[model samples]
Target: MLVIFPACSVFRFQVSQGKIIDPPWRPSIAGMIRRTKATVVPVYFEGMNTLLFGILGILKPRLRMFLLPREIIHQTGKTFKLKIEQPISYENLFEQKLQSDVEIINYLRQRTYHLAHRI
Candidate 1:
């Protein structure tokens, strides 16, 4: 039950700026979801800015652990939020071939985006 947003969906720079970029997921993840008959549960990671630190780690090519975790602790406050939306059945969603992969992924991204902004 490990749901993963492909790397392309996220922005490396945007994380440092505390922004959630819309995913650019192609048909791959969508196809997998369909084939596996998995329920698409939109999970949003809200109020996290440790990504920038990771970026720094990538840049430095050293002190990876220190920079990443320290940045996370420094940037984040005491409270953070995680939103888990209801499960969306792939079969129900894709009953018809009306929507393209981009369309479906965009809709899911919008859901996560809205959830992230709630705080």
Candidate 2:
């Protein structure tokens, strides 16, 4: 099974100041990883907020009232870049000695933001 977890509990836009505003990740994800023995893949998305906001400006109340239309969204001429980093193996987490769910999630959160810095 493939599961995607948003590290943050709430939706936050990427700021222009070049600093990522990362809130504490939900610890349950770490617990899930431990139970499922899932390999953690850190993926960072750049320019998604700009794209969505830009589309919102064009769509206005239509977007606010309804779901985003895929065809219109695809035609926005905005490019969203995704950086997929090396996966963290279940064994790797054990080797790192992350004993608690919080520690594991924090470690994964840091690794994810590290990719943003590279962009």
Reference-based lDDT, residue 48, model 1 = 44
Q: lDDT per model, in order?
A: 0.63, 0.69
Q: Which portions of model 1 miss their true places by more than 4 Å?
A: 8-11, 14-23, 51-79, 95-98
The number of the candidate with the highest lDDT is: 2
Task: List runs of model 2 lying over 4 Å from the truth.
Answer: 8-10, 13-23, 48-77
Model 2 poorest ten-residue lDDT run = 6-15
> Which lDDT tens digits does candidate 2 get at residues 8-84?
33233334544434445789889989999989889886653335544463456345224335533654876678888
lDDT of 1 by residue, 2-99 (tens): 76864343333444567534436666777677668787888876654465654674476355545555655685547756898778787766864536
In model 2, what are the clashing residue pairs, if there are any?
A: none
Worst 10 residues of 1 by lDDT: 6-15
TM-score of each: 0.61, 0.66
Error of 2 at 70 (Å): 8.3
Please give the distance, in angstroms, between residue 48's alpha carbon in candidate 1 and its true position after superposition: 2.6
